[model samples]
Target: MIMNPIPTQSSEIRVTPIPRMTQGGRWRVEAMRSYTSDLLLWFTRGQGRITVSGRTRGFGAHNAVFIPAGTMHGFEITSQVFGTAAFFPRSLNLAFPQEPLHLRIRDAAPQGDLTLILENLQRELDGDRPKKERAAENYAGLFSVWLDRAKLQYPQNERKSEKADQLVARYSTMIEEQFRSGRTVSEYAQALGITPTHLSRICNKSCGRSASALLADRILYEARRLLRETKLPVQQVAAQLGFTSAAYFSRAFQNHTGKTPSDFRRGA
Candidate 1:
């Protein structure tokens, strides 16, 4: 029998304070298609296959990976799977533990550590303390340690940042770098040597959203990241983002996230 789906909220999706992915023998995960908030994904046990954002990752006795923000990724587990996943952002600018290291273990190795992480996650899941707000902190500690070991197991291979095979690549790159400047679309068009009318037409044809919508999204992404990761006063965040005052920042944040800056920072 099919169970009715649950209701969802507009402000990015977040699951329970802590979610566990565990299953016994012979279970498979179907492809999950949905938009998740900043961070989410934890696998702790068993074995399975995950196809996310076009990359296929295997979750085994000790397989784990993080799906970056706005990355359209998910999994199709071909076997039993278990683990813990967290949806987080850049709030923790980890000092040493997050040095973009590769895991030392091969994909075929036994997943002993994966099991331990799962157990610790279970502990947190059953805890009564306020876990939702502290979730990023916990993941920082875990990721640092795991990434260290994983670094030894897997080394990263950074690809050169080249323009994509599309007309919008150059424009998209510029928008990402200057979205915080709060310039109008015409301003961006001038920098790209394109007219405002052509810019709007191309952007709309390539991206579903309008030029204004995409610019706002880029700005909001950074805003949310800064708000969550740092203890910088809200006023400072506003100034850094070119807002004249905290009040203005609050208004923009509310318009996008539907929560006041202070309220969002308070972990509500």
Candidate 2:
């Protein structure tokens, strides 16, 4: 029997609280992964660490992070940390930053302005007003303006590029592009003119994870997303993700997520 699907909100833009993103201990959010849509994270309270583009930084209250689509990132959120995560679809072609930006807003005036913009954007997306999607897009543009202005105000201090950081950044960019091609960490190291051990060591120093773990985190994140969002069969999903076979994919996925592909697809 065919079951009617549950209703979902508009995909063009979505504003959700930080805690909701991790309601079920969603490891995908905390793992090294990228999204198809640009993400704007506004942290109004508490503090934690967030890694963007292979570099980890501490974040506190009144922080805004803009991650462009296809950039690898992850963050730690504690019970005290509360904020809004806004998702803007890449297809919208809005004026979001081209690179990942982490801005610490110190002044109360700008902080309040950001809060008001987010509230207004959230309202437009949630309401049933005429042309609400268009309205939300406009507000998103304003959000982009706020980002540009804030960037000007809080210019990032230029840090010298250490060898470890450069190597890890290159490795991360490669992983983002070719993770689905079934490339191993060793192969990546070879292409980068380094040994696997050196690569893993650098990755650990840069991102607090080994090279293999980072690669697996990205691949499995895509696997879970495909299983959850698409109607593709297990075998097809495995093939698409460059796994040798469905059984192997099932084992790897279960090892990572503790659930088989089919079971995870059924929301089990």
Give TM per candidate: 0.41, 0.88
Candidate lDDT (C-alpha), each: 0.51, 0.84
Error of 2 at 2 (Å): 14
* Cand. 1 Cα-lDDT: 0.51
**TM-score: model 1 vs. ground truth:** 0.41
User: What are the per-residue Cα lDDT tens digits for candidate 2 across 144-235?
Assistant: 88888999999877688798898898898899999989988889999999999999998888878899999998888778767766788999
Residue 263 lDDT in model 2? 81
How would you encode candidate 1's per-residue C-alpha lDDT over 185-205 as one tens digit per residue?
888878877787776676565
Q: Residue 124 CA error for candidate 1 (Å)?
A: 24
Residue 43 alpha-carbon offset, candidate 2, angstroms:
0.9
Residue 114, candidate 1: how far off, in angstroms?
A: 19
- Please give the RMSD of candidate 2 to the true structure: 3.3
Off by over 4 Å in 1: 1-166
